[model samples]
Target: MTAKIEIYTWSNCPFCIRAKQLLRKKKVKFTEYGIDGDEMVRAIMAERANGRRSVPQIFINDVHIGGCDDIHNLEDQGQLDKLLFAHSGV
Candidate 1:
């Protein structure tokens, strides 16, 4: 089965855009939360991010993958694909 993914972002955040681009390139479908000025949504995102308080926080299969740089780091290490297409083999 495909891994579930989610991302918290802002409307004009470059990091968010880049993160989406990478996921799209990988053909991974993810739910996005654009919390630009919404304090309520930011609060929730912060809680879920373990007090990270940063934009572009991501989650894979309910596991927090952190921000754009973190995901990019995973890709750099040649490991992001493993998480995106996890199945019986993984």
Candidate 2:
């Protein structure tokens, strides 16, 4: 089974671009929620991100994976791929 990836971002956020680039390089399909100037949507994203109001909040198979730097750190540690491919058959 393929992993379900989601990212919350603003249209012009640099970190958001970088994060999406990394995912594209890895060839992983992802859903993006671009909440630019939308306070209500941002609030929802923050709620999902454990109160983090930062753009580029990510989720892998419904698991919160944090922001761009966090995801890059996971990739550097050789852990992101494992998380990406883990299948619980849910």
Candidate achieving the largest lDDT: 2
User: What is the C-alpha local distance difference test score of each model?
Assistant: 0.91, 0.92
- Candidates in order: C-alpha RMSD to true structure: 1.3, 2.3
Q: Any residue pairs clashing in model 1, and if so which? A: none
What number of backbone clashes does candidate 1 have, counting pairs of residues 3 or more apart or in separate chains?
Answer: 0
Candidate 1: lDDT of 62? 89
Model 1, span 2-36: residue lDDT tens:
68999999988999999999999988789999898
TM-score of each: 0.93, 0.93
Q: Score residue 75 of candidate 2 by CA lDDT.
A: 99
Q: Over the stretch 53-81, how does candidate 2's per-residue lDDT look in tens digits?
A: 99899999888999999999999999988
lDDT of candidate model 1 versus the reference: 0.91
The alpha-carbon deviation from the true structure for residue 3 of candidate 1, after best TM-score superposition, in angstroms, is 0.7
For all candidates, the clash counts are 0, 0
